[model samples]
Target: MQDSPQQPGSTGPTGSTVTSVDDPWVPSALEQERAAYRSARTRRSALVATASTLAMLGAVVALVGSSPGWPRVKETFFSWGKAVDSFPAVLDGLWLNIRVMLVCAVLIAILGLTLAVMRTVRGPVAFPLRLFATAYVDLFRGLPLLLVLFLLGFGAPALQLSGVPNSALFWGGCALVLSYSAYVAEVFRAGIESVHPSQRAAARSLGLSYGQTLRHVVLPQAVRRVVPALMNDLVSLQKDSGLIAVLGVIDAIRAAQIETASDFNYTPYVVAGALFVCLTIPMARFTDWVARRQGFHGAGGHL
Candidate 1:
């Protein structure tokens, strides 16, 4: 028996099929050519980019290696022996930095959200809270983080107040929370305000109390919108966690410093810096990924 006639939308010989009526949508020859062109162009662009990047990096390496001071610089800053010796100590200390960053990040998010809510709450009754939050944000944001760390890390212990833990690490972490929270609060506030006044109005119209509306609607959106910013802050927090070393804490930087003091070789510091870069870069890339996932265009390309 002969094959049944081709049904509409079924596959058939192109010569026998009515292209428009008998077949599903297919790329026209022009469209096919355009797609091929695009693919070739993308490959060519990638190849050019790879070559250019390798060339630029090679030039930088050659330039640096050929400099007159390269030998001394290498011995001082890039000694392989020093790096190997310091790696374990620096790695151990970096674990401390990571823990401090994680702890401070949690506290910062909580305190920052609280401050943002306080500043945004609507009512005469909340005037005092708003004032306090505003003053706190302004004061902390204006102060340099290092100065705040010094004041808290040193002066707080000097106070010797009742029921106070005078540990440098404790106070240094507190200073980090206080300073970073101010900045994070502003980021949160921006996210909160970006939610559009209509969202609050709509939630209230649904008989939701201000707190409920904020918790159910405004906050979720606000937090989602600010995630990329928050991640960036965490990245900074990871690096700055090293500053706790100033308070006599034996963090990564301090460990490197100790290792360097033996021969005044800066290699340990370089090792510490390389470790920080390794950690920070992934966080930075993750932030960009988050931005892209959320349809945000970051400064570095299309995120």
Candidate 2:
């Protein structure tokens, strides 16, 4: 006898079956439509973003161009001719800034690491050193960097110490090291604290001495974790190196000021600012890249 007709939409050995909801092999019409809709929405969003950006930029340009002082401001601050004329002097002066920044950056790193280590020492015998480190951090971090720069740059020379370098650039670099080392020390200390206690315990279990553990395991991890922060402070230090100008050092800012006073035009200051921006952008980009890479590895528990 012939078997009863198979039910509609049911699977059978000899008959074609309807698509099952759980089956991944079949594509749903709803899903295809949703994907198409999403693609359309993304394109629309991009177009809107582009249009908004263009409109906002155009509005800014129009407003600035129509301002009453636009012509004079442009002539004084944005003059291509003046920028060209002043570029040489500003570039020449930036060399001093570079030198000071490089020197202070090295000193800051060394001093900061020393302070961080001093503060982190664990024992009753180390209490005095820890207290001194704490006081040092508190004092420098509390005082404004500008005040420190002034005191070091202007005040130090007044003492007329025989062995001290009287040069403003030297004093400025010293001030930066003293001030930034405090902040950098704190950054390092935070990184050190963030390390899991188990790591230290493991090092101890392996018969490593305190100093050896710190040198081999703790500090390497701490330094790696804090590199992005260190780089950020370095960028700020690079810009603040210009503060040497206040002490009559002929840095880019000082050169620009001289040019501005002579020509009665602000273009040189703009040029100096542009030079600083150029110097800082690459460092900022590098910091960002390090942060991203560290974050990626951290997420994977590789750090």
Candidate 3:
């Protein structure tokens, strides 16, 4: 008997059977509805996360607020009136910090780079310089920054050298640069070493001198690689600018001390700390952004 006529969706001459049921699978209304349900679940999970986070924060606040010392702590440390009253003086003193930070940052960069280069040189003729640089990094990196400040701020003046500036702010800033440059020098050296050795060989093959190779080919790549680390050091330097107050430089902390002495309350110190936090947070965020952007670009480049 001849085969019955093939239906519209029936098997073809290629020996492959095709029927209505063999058509490419497409989601039915029920499947689509399930997908929509899953999406809704995802959204609900996000909402749940947000709610949980807020609940935890609120619980912490409630716990802290219920403590017996909370009232006194609030009156002393969080008084709006005292904050308002002390803001102007603290702001004025913070300007000094800003100035010192800017100057020290520039000086530190220059000094650190110099020291890094000195440490990296390879010639026997440079032995003394390399030795000196090594000694400097070891000594300063080991010493506390506060001690450096005290020595420069008080001891240097005690020497009564004729040309030394008598100003506490000036000495304190110099000490900061001295101390921070040592740390930053190590950062710079690490960055310098991270550049691939092939890069240097390539530059030399192209007839570039050692200094030219370093300046044109190596340093830039190194700096880019270490930007995040360098920024972290800078943020630390900014905070440590507060340490100058120990030298009696009349910076934000010192100004806060004066206000506290006058008012006999701790609110001024809180205000000063808030001001520092405000200044540091923006830099910290910017550093994070740079790091993330660099990571994303690096990943893309690799792909």
TM-score of each: 0.90, 0.86, 0.85
Q: Show model 2 residue runs off by greater than 4 Å.
A: 1-42, 299-303
Ranking by lDDT: 1, 2, 3
lDDT of each: 0.92, 0.92, 0.90
**Strongest candidate by TM-score:** 1
How well is each residue in 112-180 modelled by candidate 2, as lDDT tens digits?
999999999999999999999999999999999889989999899989999888998889888889999
**Global lDDT of model 1:** 0.92
- The best-first sequence of candidates by TM-score reads 1, 2, 3
Clashes of 1: 0
Q: Write the per-residue lDDT of candidate 1 for residues 13-111, one digit (tens) a residue.
A: 765543455456788899999999999999999999999999999999999999999999999999999999999999999999999999999999999
Q: What value does the lDDT take at residue 185 in candidate 2?
A: 97
lDDT string, candidate 3, 131-246, tens digits:
99999999998999989988888888877778778889888999899899999999999988878799999999999999999999988887887788889988998899999999
Return the clash pairs for model 3, or none: none
